[model samples]
Target: MSRLLDMKEFGEAAPFLRKSDLEILAAQTVAFDDKPTKNIVGAWILITDPLCAGKKRAWIPDEKDAYIEVEIREIDGDKVIVETKDGKTYSGLFCVTVNPYKWLPVYTAPVVAAYKGKRRSEAPPHIYSIADNAYNDMLRNRENQSMLITGESGAGKTVNTKRVIQYFAIVAALGEASSKKGGPATKTGGTLEDQIIEANPAMEAFGNAKTLRNDNSSRFPLKQNQSERRRGKRLLPSRQCHSYTREALMIIQWNIRAFNTVKNWPWMKLFFKIKPLLRSAATEKELAALKEEFLKLKEALEKSEAKRKELEEKQVSLIQEKNDLSLQLQAAATEKTCRLYEDQMNESKAKVEELQRQLSDTNTQRARAQAESAELGRKLEERESLVSQLQRTKNSLSQNIEELKKQLDEETKAAMMAEELKKEQDTSAHLERMKKNMEQTIKDLQMRLDEAEQIALKGGKKQIQKLESRVRDLENELESEQKKSNEFQKGVRKYERRIKELTYQTEEDRKNMARLQELIDKLQAKVKTYKRQAEEAEEQANTNLTKYKKIQHELDDAEERADIAESQVNKLRTRTRDPGSKASPKACS
Candidate 1:
């Protein structure tokens, strides 16, 4: 089975718009449908045939988006004239064109029948041939197939790529599952959405992998222009069937006007011009049929209008009835609320009276409590006075006890001082006896201390301290000298390393300079040779130009002389023909 769809129709024509002349004539005539709003103020319109009432309508722009999508409405519009040329619409994407293009006559339902199930060799050379070859090869070989298209900018590469995609989608479709090894395929069936979702990861992976150098391989949008146009339900509002009838008389007048205008449309002219006789008799038949249909539509429209008017009147009456019922309901509610409030007020009044009685009882109880509290306060005052008297007696007793303690402490201290004085008298007598004994021993000790060894021992401590200070000063000086020597060693090593680095750098610089000088000498020699050659070439060119000019001038003179001789010959011939004429010598010369 084969189904052929026109790329022309898919890209350019609406579902019902392939024959634009008649269909658009119907469009212009049916109605000037309006659904006005004040959302910064805009409206929409609907137009359809008998059963297709709300199903077909035109989008009147309501906002910047004009209702739904972004202004991407402008993409193919700008390329229509150029792209439409040569029956190739979408290939214009890859090429610069002067006119915007949409669809063409190729890849239509009729043409598709020729290629369906046909081998590559069976069909003429075409993009379909290439795609069909790939498909056949894959099925025949049981392996993958590829169609590689490579081209420079403006070479229709992208356009051909898109065609391949559409060809695969329509031809060897993967919508059904094929069993493998007698088991169910992993994926049996998927929706378009699911397939798209599955493809997203691949697109993301490939797009991200592409580099700046390969911009053409990145960011594939896979957009369907057909989807954008087809998925709309006539651009009508969600709640369709507004049920308002357009004037039948107005519609008839509009159709009469439409008949004239449709003839002028490019497609209409093409249709008539291309058709044999326009099949003229068919035109008459269609016109007659259209007139009959219009009459019937007009009559039906009138009947519907009358019925709609009647319905509108009934709707108005119903709305009024609803308002009246609502008013009655509101009045009943208000009455119920008033009755409830009155009952609450009566209950509140009873509560207030009972509360007043309770308040009086509480007042009597408060008065009884006040009398009992006063009696207790008088008892408390008496008890406080008795407590103050007891406190004063305790204070006097504590003062008497403190005085007795002070007197006892003073008497004990006086007794301790007398005992201490007696012990001191005994110690003084013993110390006086010991002093006489020490005086005898001192004379003996003085004789021993006068010896030289004892004097030397006493002086040795100062002499030893002076020597130690000298040793410490010499050690510090020695340490300072050692550190200076180490520092000099480090400086010497660093200086040697720096000298070696400088020497190496100087050698490298000398080598580089030598190389540079050699390069300069060669460049100078080449310059001298080129200069000599240039001078020689210039001399040769000048000589050749002079020779060419001299030759051209000589040739110009030769041509002039030859023209004069030829004219003289022609004159002699003319004279010979007119033998009767006398020939003057000047004319002969």
Candidate 2:
């Protein structure tokens, strides 16, 4: 009845449209109630602007614009509706839809109510739930299956597809955690490090494209991180998940190489033929002018072929120049490598010479120490000989002193025994008899007594002096022996202490010698290891040098290839740059 929607109106409505606005009014619904009803709610209603007035038609809206189909039935004053497109249903008071966002809460309320007993709606349902279910089904029920997402550009299709992948990653990872020890994880091992090193070029190439709408549109890009914690002797695990956001792009190029780039290709059958009539109508000119264009086209064709041949020749020459450049670069690199090796060789020779000098000095020091030690041994032997002679003299003097003391003790004991025996005889009789005998004997004894008295008196003085002198001599000898003994004991103690110290020094020297030997062994091993490493390094350097030379050659070859391509391109361009080119060609004979 009113002016129908135009392109501007449709565009605006797509973004901001109310459900009630597209629906038939309550008055119209009541009028049509008795007949087969055309309820606007949940029904497709097409509106078109016809050039001719008063003619109307309805067509089904495909998944082309903002349209969805629903099924509804009335019960008293309420409408029970199922959103067939998204598989959701609702029961509510029969009223025309006004706001979709506002109505979503109303529609999903019934689903919430139905599932409330099971706590199925504990978390708020988001758009991702659909994708989550699909992901689970694919992984659990349909393993090895593929998912295809087809849609027009900028329809949130790519975003939805990414959401599906995330759903799989999250749910599967959680499941893996429940089954495995250490939970949802990522690779923190060396393999991941290697992969990261390898992925640089892939990211650069695939995720870059120029677009008018988007300055740089990336199809896929990713970032990864690994974290590690020491758990006792082992490292704890980590988790990784991919998050993706999408943007739409405009003005993309499509390749026509297989289809339309060449004539009489198999795919050419797919396109409609261009007859002479169609071609004739494209230009506005007379027959004679058209023939003149045909002749020009022939000339242009010939010129193009000549340019092609010239480009090919130039390309060959450019290749030869690039090869020559490569050889020169390789030669320079070899000279530089040889110079570096020579420097290393000189340094090694100098180090060897210095070590030899040090070895010679150490040998001279060892010889001098041996001579000094031998002199000390000779002095020690002489002192031992003197000690032995002094010990023999002291033993001889002790034996002589012992023999003299024994003889003096025996003489004193005999004199005491004779005095006791004389007192034991009969006293008076013996005295009277002895008196007569004594008187007679006295005269004879007197003479003997006088002689004995004379003898006793003379010997007493000499014997007394001799005994006194002998006592003095013995006391001096005993004092000297005691002093010598004390000296010997003191010397023994000193020598014992010295021996103990020497024993301790010997043990320490042995330990030190062992440690030194160990250190020398370790140093020798290290020297051998370093030598091997140096040799390996030298070999590796040579290999790398070879590779570098090869790369230089390749670079030269690439340059030559580039030069050749450029020359060919230039020659073709020059040939094409004539004053005029034919626009048309004559028909085949």
Q: Which candidate number has the best lDDT?
A: 1
- Clashes by residue pair, model 1: 4-109, 6-108, 79-100, 79-101, 80-100, 80-101, 81-100, 82-99, 82-100, 84-101
Please count the clashing residue pairs in each candidate, in the order shown: 10, 2
lDDT string for model 2 (1-589, tens) is 1223221322323223223333636545665333322233444322221221232222223454554543332222222222234432444222122223232332232321221212113322333333344444544576433334434444444454444433333343334443355432332224433333333222222232112112212322221122233322221121111111111111111233434455566555434464545667556566768899999999999999999999999999999998998877865665565555455545544544554454455445444444444444444444444444444544453454344335434533443353344333434445665577658756855764566577676676765565578569757866875696577567656656755665565566556556655655665565555556555555655655565555555556555655555555555445444322432333221
Q: State model 1's lDDT.
A: 0.49
Give the per-residue Cα lDDT of candidate 1 at 308. 100
lDDT values for all models: 0.49, 0.44
C-alpha TM-scores of all predictions: 0.21, 0.19
Please write out the lDDT profile of model 1 over residues 223-326, one tens digit for every residue.
33446555354334311312111243346568879989898999998888788975888999999999999999999999999999999999999999999999
Q: Which ten residues in a row have the lowest lDDT in candidate 1?
A: 77-86
Cα-based lDDT at residue 454, candidate 2? 79
